[model samples]
Target: MWIIFGILTLIMTLLNLYMYNAGKNYHIFMVLSLFLMALTLCDQYQMIASWSLAGDWSAIADVAPTLSMILWIFVIGSFVVNVIPLLLSYRKNR
Candidate 1:
């Protein structure tokens, strides 16, 4: 599973880079894909961490705080960075 997710992340990252350089409007898709990949990795990490803890996971909620934080931050940030501009421009253009 980890290997699969790692490969997926790599593929998405590569796709993002290619899309970026292709001079196409791909930021939205690229960011979404990257964010999803990141979240998937974070979830995988949490699963591993949970298994490692095994009924003794101290402060389970605290484990991999950064993972969730980073996931949501990137998700929301990407939306703000990409969508807001599109919206503003759309409104302005209209």
Candidate 2:
């Protein structure tokens, strides 16, 4: 679930970038990016909760934190990549 959401988020982010470049209305993509990001976070938390319930201490300890960190980085990096170009274009237009 988390992996699926993560991949969707990446694809949406790329679509956002493409929309920006094409001078299309990318606001819907922006909204979808944020929505997908939230879904991904929820999926990650659910995964951690399942591991905790199953008493998988090793996975909880060894994987969860690091995976969360990587997820955050990927989300932020993709978001910035999508938004910065739009910002630049706005300033360029002005």
Candidate 3:
């Protein structure tokens, strides 16, 4: 999951950069996506730390309050924000 998020985040970040450079006025979505991507990276770090300390397969899977879910929410929300604005723009242009 982390790897998947990481790759998606990279792609989105690049797209965001392009959009911003193109003067699309989509700063909020860009910033939100960037933040979520950073959060995903942090979650990956937490997982690594937990695994290293536990040194046991079972304990690695038992860590509570994992931040993965929250990160997912942020990712999905960012996507929604990006899509909604584009949709609104499309409707207006039509």
Candidate 4:
């Protein structure tokens, strides 16, 4: 599941980069996508370490999950913000 998510985020980051270069006003999406990719990588690392060490999860317990959760919140918030403008514009046009 993590691998699948990582792949999906990787694709999103790539698409954002493409959109950013193709035109204007996509900088925020690109930046957020990059941030999400970084967070996903960090989460993957933490998961690997936790699995390898088995009973030593305490070492990363203080920070990893909390930071990941915070990043997820930001990612979701940004997605909502990005979608709202488009939805409003579509509604206005209709």
| Each candidate's clash count | 0, 0, 0, 0
Which lDDT values do the candidates have, in the order given?
0.59, 0.83, 0.65, 0.62
Let me know the TM-score candidate 2 reaches against the reference structure: 0.86
Residue-by-residue lDDT tens digits, candidate 3, 51-91: 87878656556543465575567667656755655676677
Candidate 2 per-residue C-alpha lDDT over 45-68 given as tens digits, one digit per residue, 9 for 90 to 100: 888899999999998999977897
Q: Which ten residues in a row have the lowest lDDT in candidate 2?
A: 77-86
Identify the runs in model 3 with alpha carbons over 4 angstroms from their true place. 56-94
Candidate 2: Cα lDDT at 52? 94
Comparing 3 and 4 on TM-score, the stronger one: 3
Selected candidate, larger lDDT, 1 vs 4: 4
Sorted by lDDT (best first), the order is 2, 3, 4, 1
Tens-place lDDT digits, model 1, residues 1-94: 6456545655655565565457556565556655666676676677857766686555555655665686566556544544544465577679
User: At residue 17, what lDDT does model 2 achieve?
Assistant: 82
| Candidate No. with top lDDT | 2
Error of 1 at 23 (Å): 0.7
In order of appearance, the predictions have TM-scores of 0.43, 0.86, 0.45, 0.43
